[model samples]
Target: MATSSGAPAARTFFGHPWGLATLFFTEMWERFSFYGLRAILVLFLIAPPADSGLGMAEGTAKALLGVYMAMVYFVALPGGWIADRVLGARRAVLAGGVVIMLGHLSMAIPGGAGFVYLGLLLIIVGTGLLKPNISTMVGKLYQGQPDARRDSAFSIFYMGINIGSLAPFVVGYLGEEINWHLGFGAAAVGMALGLVQYLLGARHLAGVGDRPGDPLTPAERGRVLRIAGTVAAVAAAVLLIFAALGRLTVDGVTVALTVLAIVVPAAYFAFMFRSPEVSAEERVRLRAYVWLFLAAALFWMIFDQAAGPLNIFAQRSVDLNVFGWQMPASWTQNINPILIICFAAVFAWLWVRLGDRVSTPQKFAFALVMCGLSFVVMSVASNAAAGGARVSLLWLIAVYLLQTLGELSLSPVGLSVTTRLAPRAYASQMMGVWFLATAAGDAVGGQVARLQEPWGDVRYFLLLGACTMAGGVVMFLFTRSLRRLMGEERRAVPSAV
Candidate 1:
């Protein structure tokens, strides 16, 4: 057991520190808001103006959603740095929660497209601040505990995320079935509840996240501020110039972000590999990680399409009839989280029981294959749709189930490997580098989904599925060498949800 501030360890929540409960619930609500809004974002965009939506084209809507998602992850790099060197995790989380609340509220107000854009900007900045820091604080709760305990705490915290992800069923139903603003308002309410609990449970976290991991001295702080200010000014000026030239369209912004999302990770890898700080052994591990990163990106590119094209598929092509009622299309988005909650424990146990029978690289290969199969399911469903028949909702549910399994295989393993292989001096930066993989996946996935309009559903799904399967095969062939690069010893598997 780990003690906080030199006091005896107290087991207040399920034999874990009380702070875990606070952070857990806070994160749950934050995720509830995030996923809730995401579940309905594209649907809201494509809905007719008569339905209180912006009446945007489906392609444009998907592109915008992609850009927003990419930015949310991309900003985490600076957000983590700010928490570690400036405001500390606690204050950063608080400030982030406030901004997130305002963002949701702004969206809840039925004004114009400007409100939507403003809300997204605030939520992106707020998520950048909160997402990485809250997880850091969870680790702090078990600071001096054994690795087992810390791993257990993380498992509990991950459940909070899955539980929160379920909120889209409720919030999404409201937004898609009733009114868009109302759903946004409900998300705002969820965050408000989180903030209230966070305040009430402040006592449990007395010694945690109170200060930065590495605070800056006065001179260093001044220099950083100056640099940040200069960069902001230059960025603002460039944006203004683009807007004045009538060139700052949504398509333009999406293209720019897509390029940035791809380029940043490549640049990070180049910098890390070339840096003298990385040992030869660490460099070998980094090489292995790069391969894993590419596989992870491919998996996410397919999996994350759930929120864009899949949502559209559910609404337009799938039969939504239940026993006696037609369900809302947003309800389809709930399948993945629901399945994750149901099967995560079973997968965790299977991994432990199987032990060295499955290596990390092997798991990545499995995930890629599973992801391709999931899309294959969708491809078949699209064939049915092409015949002018609305496929059973069960088809979509099957796709989600397969994709959820793929997610379980890859996501947790990737997190553990990144932590294990990261160079000590660049640990945080390495974590940011890992997130860049997701940024690339989302940006590219969105663009790929856009192809559906031109390529048609059958060809789009088949092409993506075939390409993904090929990638998996290539990864499988390379797994032996990658595992060698990871070193010969079988390491203990870290806990992942």
Candidate 2:
């Protein structure tokens, strides 16, 4: 069992206790590795040969990014399956860390394109295994309605993600600016550290990820085989089709993703609509959750830009001056995590104080608006930069603050909502699908990020901000109906007899 860090044990820091610190630190390092590579990813790819890069075109870089992110999130579907049915969450997470470490190490190696691509493949596969399972473990830590502290727990966990995110900028500063392989090497080391800590903490986990030790019943075993077969068939079909078309690039990939985007969710809805297993009201609620998932995806599409175009914009246009020191543009990536740690507590407190009054739908609505608003700041900064040499760093900070608040409102809630709303039999797969939606959104964001304007940076920001706000407004307009559909705010009032 992993020993606690000498911190006092309480009923709930917000709502959870054991395994949090374990998960927190584990996720922290994991994010550190993930985001560290991400921080310098585009910069490295786009950097001039004078700076030792392949000097790939922006469109190609974005396309590669889309494919990379799509693979990462898409693989999670199978990863979640393995966690639920075979390896269990604990082993899956550890295995994922190892895979990621290998990937990062591969990236660290010099002069081998095959090695670099292979490393990316490894990292993507590893993330698929680790990401959803670790999150599943976090959900496992709570049972029933997890009270106000649940958000705080997620916030703390969220901080770990940011803590991990913060390291990349530092690593990027040192590695990318000085030595490219160094950054990749640092990411590998980070994952290795995560694997070690996760193993050390295994004892504290108890029943969390303990898989069913016995051989599966014939029916369950058959179901597993069926699912695996279905997934394999689907993947094979998609790849064969793609190969035949001779169409593989940013546009081709995006079109495929967009066209298929509605299919999964739509199929899920069709299944729920036809199934007799669930009550009609339950179906309504499930449908609402699906919409929430869609809206959440839209929000992430905009917010995720922080790592892509926003990172570039910050590096190029934003002025970072503090006490006679100019912070690297990539360092702005740290701001979101820093704010997450600070506001997580406050947001948790707000929920505690406002219990039952604030609906999940409302939170979702807030997230959408915040995501949209963050883009506006980006637009404003871009516009301002037209006249001036450098826009104030404060604009970047403002955007992060809004985006973080939006994230605080919705992101953690997503895990809880999915676990609560999804059917018992479909828990892990459902979560995987939810994450797959995220992958879809990320793919979209990558496409949008590449489609810059004639006015350069200003056009993308304005379009993104408007689109984000429009999505939010659409959600808000439907808020009452959505609330009703979700059955989220209902209270058992006494009859007036």
Can you write out model 2's per-residue Cα lDDT over 323-354, one digit (the tens) per residue? 99877666788888889888877887897677
Model 2: colliding residue pairs: 1-203, 14-149, 15-149
lDDT score for candidate 2 against the true structure: 0.77
Error of 2 at 27 (Å): 1.9
Error of 2 at 294 (Å): 1.9
**TM-scores of the models, in the given order?**
0.95, 0.85
Please state every model's RMSD to the true fold in angstroms: 3.6, 4.7
User: Which lDDT tens digits does candidate 1 get at residues 84-162?
Assistant: 9999999999988989999999999999899999999999999999999999999888877799999899999999999
lDDT, candidates in the order shown: 0.89, 0.77
